[model samples]
Target: MDLTPESNQDDEAVGDLSFDPKGALDAGDGAVLTRLARAVEAVDPVPDDLVERSLFAITLAGLEADLMEAVYLDTPLAGVRGAAAAARADDTAPAEAKTITFTHDSLTVMISLSPAAGGRVRIDGWAAPAAGLDVELHRPGVDVVTVASDEDGRFAFDSVERGRASLVVRRTDGGGGAVSTPVIEL
Candidate 1:
């Protein structure tokens, strides 16, 4: 006799969900899993924006917004980027004062770095199309700092300790999405 119970032809009720264990994997299941694993391994595992999102999450203090593109001082660093720096024997060290620019679709921010007393750094920043905005300074292992920009879109962080840092700018009027700059060495 068959072990399975015969269903009533006249029954109209729906079948109950089965809770019984399906038991351990068999050779067929293992083969399917192996094929799936191989297929996954054939493609790149990491997402292209993983690094950008992770950095934004950690450095931007959990700000949800678009990331601004960093415009390296290309004109200023042309020599450093090329063999010109290597050819120069007089001043081989990187410049003490560095300028960086970050831009988004709606905003543009420029910052200047200068040395301060006690081996600290001073950051002077200016945003274009002068408007009310809040600027946040982020450094690893340190509290996030938020500052307000002046009418001229000028802001400054005085006597900041030297380290890697990032800047996040947001509109004070809450008009648009926030934007962040890539972390850079101070």
Candidate 2:
């Protein structure tokens, strides 16, 4: 027996076999969901700026960007050799400098933060397995400052402000993609 519907009578009879389109849609409370979504949107629509920012973030995430996570290691202050003397010098003096280390599969970066003249911070960095590379320093509210590593894989950025900052290291020839460290407080 061919069960396939061929005539109008067969099609109309098929409709009696437990086929309820509205009930199917309501089985999972889908109608309630649709109503809730519409009500919420009418009550408070999403902000345009937030939508723009979300789109921008999604676009950036879609880019082929490799991000390296820099781990913070506990180390002594970079420029403070005489911790006791420096502590005794002035009670109102600025905080001691910091040393940060970032390790990746290909390279390891170590940097020392010290106070420079004119109330600015100086960054001294070294790359291990030593090859000259490009180093970038990013500070909040300031243009990104960049420097090139010497033959010894050493780089420095002087007169940088004291605040949140981060670093990126890349090949001098721009061959490999850049790697970035986590943001740190200066």
Candidate 3:
């Protein structure tokens, strides 16, 4: 599948959405997304001003007018806008939200990040061939952990740090796979 961000064909309106990378479907007003789309179309490298322009468009639309918002940095859509990540899913729902699946040898795993307790990051993972697995968080620092799953093959990182992180899983057989959840700055 073509995952290039430049593909406007993916912008085909899906039930009113104009194919948001952040997956913010337009229910009515297209101002913010329209400006985003135009900016994306105008240059190979999107200008930095587009963020302010998008925020301005959102402001004009009166969306969350009081609090600060932007396409980058901190924004509601940035939190869970995994539509690009969704393309890797085995199945696609109309909602356009999905998980990434990695398989190695007899092991198959699906992983995603969510808000953890105490304002930490949550690593929710499911694996096949239920066994002891090593989960590592890689960023500027490395956190190594090993976890054995229940009969259902589910594991989690409840107190993971909030920032860009990747999950690497190692199986007992020494073969493993990794999936990088989209960078989320909490």
Candidate 4:
């Protein structure tokens, strides 16, 4: 029971000789890990498409609850053939209708935006694999307008103010997750 430094020394000498488990990474260990990461990155760099998809997925994760994931497929404006000058001229011309598509696991939503009277845009939308769902149009600082899809899975929002907007499709029965499209400019 006489606890002395010499006794403690003797106990430790005969006790487990294993070294203390490493806790935090030391500078050299961290350097080695950094080198390893660099080597891996060099050997197989991340794909550009994969990174884009990952960011898209992250955005979907932050979306409203009960909303299904939808990926932006394409916009007609993206395919317009013109240089900067031509594009500027085109912008000055009468605004023509443009189509955009968003895809979900179960359905595809397509919408055409056309300029209407009173400086508003008309949104006509269709959903493939048709279902009687309600489509809601969302715009910042504006009241949400909702319309039920016809038997043909077609819906329309008239007199939508020009600006950024998005869409959400939900089953009338509220049985499944709602589908949301990315915000787009009209």
TM-score of every model versus the real structure: 0.59, 0.54, 0.40, 0.56
lDDT of 4 at 9: 50
By lDDT, the candidates rank as: 1, 4, 2, 3
In order, what lDDT does every prediction score?
0.73, 0.66, 0.49, 0.67
Which lDDT value does model 3 have at 26?
Answer: 62
Error of 2 at 166 (Å): 1.3
lDDT of 1 by residue, 68-156 (tens): 88886564644221322232222344435666788899999998877676667789999997998999898877998999999999999
* Candidate 4 lDDT tens digits, 24-84: 6667777889999999999998743345434543454454634444443443345411222
Q: What is the lDDT of residue 68 in candidate 3?
A: 16
Residue 18 shift from truth in candidate 2, angstroms: 45
**Top TM-score model:** 1
Residue 105, model 2: lDDT of 80
Best of the two (2, 3) by lDDT: 2
Q: Which residue pairs clash within candidate 3?
A: none
**Which one wins on lDDT?**
1
Residues 1-186 of candidate 3 have per-residue lDDT tens digits of 766677667455454644554655565447777888889878776643446434433433321112211122322362343442342232333333234455544556666655444545456778777766665544434444555555567887677664444445555445543323222322
Candidate 1 residue 133 Cα shift, in angstroms, is: 1.0
lDDT of model 1 at position 32: 85
Order the candidates by TM-score, highest first — what do you get? 1, 4, 2, 3
